[model samples]
Target: MNDQNLLERYIHEVGAHLPRRSRPDVQLELRSLLLDELAARGLEADNPADAAGVAELLKEYGHPEELAARYHTEQFLISPLAFPAFRLSYGIAAAVVTVVFLVGLGLRLNQGGLDLTELAGFLGSYIETMLLNFGVVAFVFYLLEGLGWIKPAKTGAGWDPHKLPAVKDPDRINRTELLVGIFFTIAALLVFNFVPHWIGIVSWHDDGIGVVPILSDQFLTYVPWLSALWVSEVALKALVYRAGRWTRRLRLAEFALSLASIYVLYTIVQNAVIAKLAIVDGIAKFALWILLGIALLESGWQLYRLLSGKANHPLGVPSIRENQ
Candidate 1:
């Protein structure tokens, strides 16, 4: 990643931990400060670094949680000196709400089977009560602190930067995209293999709803191989989602999948009869060719990225160095 990308990621992580109303302002200021810091140290923001390369600076700056806390405490409703007590009080009250909710649920279950409507109402109330409890407790503390009636006994003197976490990468895959891919992939696998006829147009008859089989017998021959590839693709996507970043191995795996996809698409367009109907076959072949082109482009880019290591940081959490 470039110095600028790293700077943005660090700021983004900090902003994610910040309250919604303060996020944009905090991120903007944080970005400016980080850029200034990098420039002061003679670092070039436009140039690509072998790593985030600013791990040391980030560590010394503060952990995401601590930095967010520092800003959060300074908000209008809360001050740093009163924050510890406010947090403790809120925690205790929240626990009481949970206990009350659980007790009510137990009583209802013991009396009779809880219907869905009653269960939903109970859940709604539980959520509302918890939020109400939090607001009440926080407001009381806020007032007490404002009136100088409550304060922390001592200020924190030994916060550790070593306990900090990490940030994002430009190459970071979208988890929602992966989840959607998995869903479509699995659905296709089921439809193609177990219910091939479902792919065609649906018709409503006097007897019942009917579906005409659109896939040719040749598709049956390729089902096992295609299903295997689809399954592999889903598995890899799931792994990337779990890791929250792409690693070298995952990139290679995806590249390999792209190659396999290109092969399957090429073969289908050239040799396989995807649809028994003439017009459908023509349309399917055209679509397959388009997919093949996309696969080739994606594979080439993946190989280039692997070789160049242009973005030095692989996906997942970009690790920051601990204070020495």
Candidate 2:
């Protein structure tokens, strides 16, 4: 067959399995590569007898397997980190995009200025972005699977079923740990809300749930809910730190609860009290940011110790580097 014919079949075979959005580009590139390889082998499209030799050359290049592997390696699941992170980030992005699209549609329907044509145009753009994102993510996972880096184990004699210990505990939150977590969490809340209000950064709420302090400015809200969120997060972190093992289900429950609390608080404050809070504007904000930074560092250090099998001691247990 001619170079064009050879390239057509080759590109079709490979691109058929790839993401549709990227199929055209990948097809073009693969065709070019095949032509170059054929040319390098001294094969000519003009000579009719050179057809079989060209076919043989294409066959030797391996039945689109190597090309598929290359596509996977170069474009998708490049590493272990990339694999799981891609899944998470893609899921989050998809959710955000879906919400934005729905909101835009609702707004357009409510507003009289937006005609059907304009609505269709806006929707077309949204659909395009959604499709492109989905294709890219799918291709990434496909590539990762194609490569051996993320391949499933063959389950042979070398595997020891009993030696692999479980990292999770069914009873994750014990009474003692839970009590201690509540204590520290309550203390932190008192420091942030009550103490700050006493010093004039905010005001203590006397009307409703008086345990949490409310912001002084009517235009600045979301403080109470945010304080509650931070408190819960601190409690969860404490539980995890003290126990060191929790069921996946429990961890997920905690995450959902914390996020829901933040979202609800944000919504209520934005609608009822103030649209936004200027957490970036004051000494209190700066101090809170500093505390957050220190907490992150401490958490990271603790995680490192756990991973390095040195988590026998509690958090803040210094290493040799600290002494140095």
RMSD of each: 17.2, 21.3
In model 1, which residue pairs have backbone atoms overlapping below 3 Å? Answer: 1-312, 245-316
True-structure lDDT of candidate 2: 0.52
Q: Which predicted model would earn the best lDDT?
A: 1
Top candidate (TM-score): 1
Tens digits of per-residue lDDT for model 1, 194-254 = 9887888679999999988888998678888899899999899989898887888888888
The list of candidate 1 runs beyond 4 A from truth reads: 1-168, 311-324
- lDDT for 81 (candidate 2): 29
Worst-scoring 10-residue span by lDDT in model 1: 315-324
In model 1, the Cα lDDT at residue 268 comes to 63
TM-score of 1: 0.48
Off by over 4 Å in 2: 1-134, 140-154, 163-171, 174-180, 198-215, 219-264, 271-324
Instruction: Please give the lDDT score for candidate 1.
Output: 0.69
